[model samples]
Target chain A: MISIDWYLALSAILFCIGIVGVLIRKNAIVIFMCVELMLNAVNLSLVSFSSHYGNVDGQILVFFSLAIAAAEAVVGLAIIIAIFRNNFSVDITQINLLRW
Target chain B: MITYSFIFLAVLAVATALGLVISKNTVNSALFLVLNMVSLSGVYLLLQAQFLAIIQILVYAGAIMVLFLFVIMLLNIDEEESLFNKFRIKYFVAFLLGVGIFAQLIYSIGSFSDTLPVVSAQMAEAGTVEAIGDVLYTKYSLPFHIIAMLLTAAVNGALLVAQHKTKPLTEEND
Candidate 1:
């Protein structure tokens, strides 16, 4: 039987990858994808814990999290599109109009 | 069998995530994210989250990713520059910080001496759609309604934000 630690470890690794992606990548969409990866990693851990405890609460939380993620994606992509419309680019470094 | 499946799904998940990061083309990155989401759903199934497995594929892979791709195509963005062409000290520091956070998480997880409880029949039932609906409707009903409202707001907000506004004819004359 696989230990829950293994799943948790995997979650950590995926989350870290997301962090690195977010930090190093310049494209706004890629950064958004990295955030999604981090969210999925958390969902994986939550599901594992829910199974470990023989309870439904964690799964319920995951369900809510999934909904929120979808909503975030919709709004976030819309914002990115709006930015691209005005700026003609999605590179994060280039969209520094607010930088003083 | 389960262990082997877990290992395979875990490796696939990590690999696709890395692919999403490393690919230069935004379209390729989007495709990689789709693959990553699919692999994660496989992991969800391994964890006995049957309902979530389906939702992950449907909501994430099916709906959200399609939106990403649609925007990518609609925008027709150019491929990004090479990853390290403009590497700065700040990026290196960020990488180190990510590594530090990962190590901290791993160390904390390692320090836990107590093993997770074995999966019982009740745990298996908790993953079912019926069981989740039961709890979601009863104990978490308010949150459920809130989520519905949030979704509606998100849809309206996205439409409002993304709509193209025509420039005033007088402003164009200026």
Candidate 2:
């Protein structure tokens, strides 16, 4: 039988990678993708824990999280589009109007 | 059999995520994210979360990624110049933060000595659609309805944000 720790470890690794990507990537879209990666990693661990406990609650939570992720993606990408429209660039370094 | 499949899917997921980060082109990054999502669905299947696996594929790989690709193509964004050109200090700090968090997580996992319960037939049944549906409708019904409203709001918000504001004729004349 596979140990639950292994799944948890994988989740941690993926989550860290997502964090690194978000911090290092310059493009807003790529940063958004990294955020999705982080969400997926969380979902993986949630499902694993659900299976481990033999409870359906964790899976149900994953369902709601997935829905929320979809909603976030929609609004986030639209914001990215709006930013692109005004600035004509999606590079984070260049879109520093808010930076004092 | 399941162990080997789990390893493969886990490796694939990690590799694709790295690819998404490394790829300079926005479209390529989006494609890598698609691959990553697909591989994660496979992992979900191995974990016996059948419904979640399907939703991961449909909602993440299918819907969200399509929107990403559409925006990437529509915008025609230029490839990023380089990953670490201007932000050496930032990249180094980010790497250190990643390593620190990873070390903490691994330490926690290592210290956890309790053996997880073995998967049984009952556990398998817990992942089924009927089981989840029962719990979701009864215990989580309020959240479900809230999610419906959230989706509706998100759609309207997206439309409002993405809508191009046309200048009045007077402004154009000026």
Candidate 3:
């Protein structure tokens, strides 16, 4: 039988992988993708817990998270596009204007 | 069928994540990210969070990633052949962060060996759909409304930002 522990473990592993991607990837857009990955990982964990506890709280929380993620993605894409248009590049290294 | 589906999705998710890392082109990375999101949605289904799984596909794979693809299309990104240049320090920092997180996870798993057996039966008498609506209305109603407000503000902010095209100040000086 498949176990919730196993599901939780998988979610944890995915979360770590996403964290690595966010920390390591040099492209700003890739970093944004990694952020999405991390959010999904958290969503996995939330679903697992909600199911395990027999409550709908997890699902509702997931709904809120999805909304927040959508908003974040829209805003992030807009900012990145603005940056890309001016610099003619997508690599995070080149957009170091914030490094005062 | 369940086991096979889980294995396939798990493999696909990891592979696509690797694809995201190895591919040099922005468009390719975005595509891989979409693949990863799709696989993740499958995982969500296995967990019985059907609503969440659908939202995952619609929001992440459908809506947000498409926006990303369009931005990639609109930008000056050419097919990058080589990305490993003089940016060694950034690579090192990312590597360290990954490794550190991995180590912490391993240690936590090791310490959790005495965990109680995972309860197989979900306790709530009501189904997942019903329970979720109840909690959202009762315990989490305040936060739910607040999140809606936050999302509205974000949409307005994005629209405002997109419309403001700040031309070069030098051009304005003439």
Across all models, the iRMS values in order are 1.5, 1.5, 2.6
Candidate 1: misplaced stretches above 4 Å?
Answer: B84-87, B166-174
Predicted candidate 1 versus true structure: per-residue lDDT over B22-138, tens digit per residue: 988889988988998898888888878899999999999999999999989999974866653256886887789899999999999777536555354687788999999998999
Recovery fraction of native interface contacts for candidate 3:
0.53
| Chain B of candidate 1 vs. true chain B, TM | 0.89
TM-score of chain A of each: 0.97, 0.97, 0.94
The docking category that best describes candidate 2 is: medium
> Which of the numbered candidates is closest to the native, going by highest lDDT?
2
Q: TM-scores, in order shown?
A: 0.93, 0.94, 0.85
Cα error, candidate 3, residue A62 (Å): 2.0
Residues B1-174, model 2: lDDT tens digits: 988988898899899989988887888989999998898898888888899999999999999999899989899984767763278899899999999999998889767636666343467899888989998889899999999999999999999899898435564553
- Residue-level lDDT of model 2, residues A43-74, one tens digit each, is 98898888878888889989999899999999
TM-score for chain B of each model, two decimals: 0.89, 0.89, 0.81
- Evaluated against the true structure, the overall lDDT of model 3 is 0.75
Q: Please give the fraction of native interface contacts (Cα pairs under 8 Å between A and B) kept by each candidate.
A: 0.77, 0.75, 0.53
Candidate 1 has what TM-score? 0.93
**Sort by TM-score, best first: what order?**
2, 1, 3
